[model samples]
Target: MAMEASMVKAVIFDKDGTLFDFTATWGPWTADLLRDLADDAAHADRLARAVGFDLSTCRFDPASPVIAGTPGDSARALEAALPGMTLDAIVRILIERSRDVVPAPAVPLAPLLSELTDRGLALAVVTNDAEGPALEQLDGHAHHFAFIAGCDSGHGAKPDPDPLLAAARALGHAAEDCIMVGDSLHDIRAAHAAGMRALGVLTGPATELPGAEAVLPDIGHLPRWLDATT
Candidate 1:
């Protein structure tokens, strides 16, 4: 059953695949990073496997830590692959690369967010990406978000509920008064754990998340879904 939009006072979005097209936004960057870190084909393959990416396809496994893991998690994976590199150094590299990425929004964001705000719903972004890059990705749209938390924001990361709960608290809404929209199981699971409604989107590799109240083609359809449900 669709959740009643009337009951939702806030909307929390997962960045990366939720707000932006995961492949379009991150595929090239991942490929480039792997190449820069590896000295040879054999080494590149090792790094790819360590991060759960397939070099041949340049696609990440749905279970890949890179898909939903925090920068520290990714650094750990990279550290395993490159024994000489320290975790902090790996983290710095990832953060630097991330800031340079140009996000490809799943839909035009400003107008859509405006519509939601006009409806009196508070908005936020809770992402596993580092806070710096997440903010850079939002750019002009950053002002629309009432709260923005990243892995480094000290709220912890999803599929833990700390960040989601923090976002709700920041917005002055109870967990049940918020909806979390994302394109991964981590996002859905976090919402469930946080006592918020979960709405999944297919802009990423995830297609059939088990606990999503609705699986959408993309966030572009969210307004209509909200209207119909409310």
Candidate 2:
């Protein structure tokens, strides 16, 4: 079937899961954080549970706020497990640790992004992460994005249209001429609220997103969609 018509001038992506493989990138970080911050094994378990992560499996549950929330949200969740740590301290640690993370791309990023750009499509990222760490993670590939914003970037987070709208403006495109691609419901909701089209991918924990126009295996398929639609 034909997808959207050839009107999309910009593409806004969700960072963690859409661009990179979320679990492969963040599972170790969360596990280490739990163990390091917790006083003991039981405490680690509490921290894990608080964030909806599995210590044994090193996997995040589908509903984990960290999967689609800001660093502040995750920090507050962790604070419930660590009585001694203030939200500020946890956020600092998260940002510090996040700065060094090695991202595992969901697909080859350079070529994919280049393909989209080569087609004259403006690209941007709107994520629930902090601006600092999100930039750090995308350092080498940052050139492909015309704009990048996180929750702390003053645009607000996903499930809200502000950030997406901001990115669209930065990319110099109208909301109707853009698409938001991500791996969660938050992405779809943001796109809908912003009046852009939405596409869902399976690189993240969300296997189904009822709000998306279509769900594909990963971003590798995006070019095809663009081709068909355009």
Candidate 3:
């Protein structure tokens, strides 16, 4: 059930699987990028040698519940795979390539976001992605958010309290006064670590998610949950 608005000052969200269909949004881009990489003899060999997976045989396999991790740690994972490459360079490539991967706005997540703003609730995004793609996705939904921050934006990522805590601070609210909404257990854990409540949505594969205050079907039902809470 949704908690009262009086009990919640703001809402923190995770991007990707939570807001939009992850596969529909990022899968194509990943597939195309892998294809392009595989087509390059050097990069193809690197993919086989580094990741031990052939780029050509790859498909954009959708992963379960999206969560967050430490910014530097997460970045390092991507960077470590591409030795000697600057983080900035890698992030730029990912962001540029991701442009071809469009979000499924048909999910009506944008309207829900606008509704949250209209309800006078503060909003922010704390994603696990690098700052570049994070901002690009947010700006793509510019009509929705009042403030958006990413794990790479400096505070931290999910599964740690830093990101949620920073977002609460930015919204001028206490952690207890904010609610974290996402599609993963990592998000739920993060909210708990941050001293906030969590609402998980089943928009993504549910098996990978952790516990939450409530688990609903998707963001579209969030309004109803909010109504129940209020």
TM-score per candidate, in order?
A: 0.95, 0.96, 0.76
| lDDT score at residue 187, model 1, on the 0-100 scale | 94
TM-score winner: 2
Displacement of residue 50 (Cα, Å) in model 2 is 0.7
TM-score attained by model 1: 0.95
The TM-score of candidate 3 is 0.76
Backbone clash count, each prediction separately? 0, 0, 2
Tell me the tens digit of each residue's lDDT in model 3 across 1-230: 23333477788878876786654565456546545645367765554444223345432222312223333442344565566568776556655675555666426766787888888888888777666766666666755655577666778677888978988888899888998888776788888888888898766545445558777777788778888885
Give residue 21's lDDT in candidate 2 (0 to 100).
93
Ranking by TM-score: 2, 1, 3
45-154, model 2: which lDDT tens digit per residue? 98899999998988999999899988888998888777777889889998888887789999999999999999999999999998988998999999999999989999
Error in Å for residue 34 of model 3: 1.3
Give, for candidate 3, the lowest lDDT window spanning 10 residues.
59-68
Show model 3 residue runs off by greater than 4 Å: 1-6, 39-92
* Model 3 residue 88 distance off true place after TM-score fit, in angstroms: 6.9
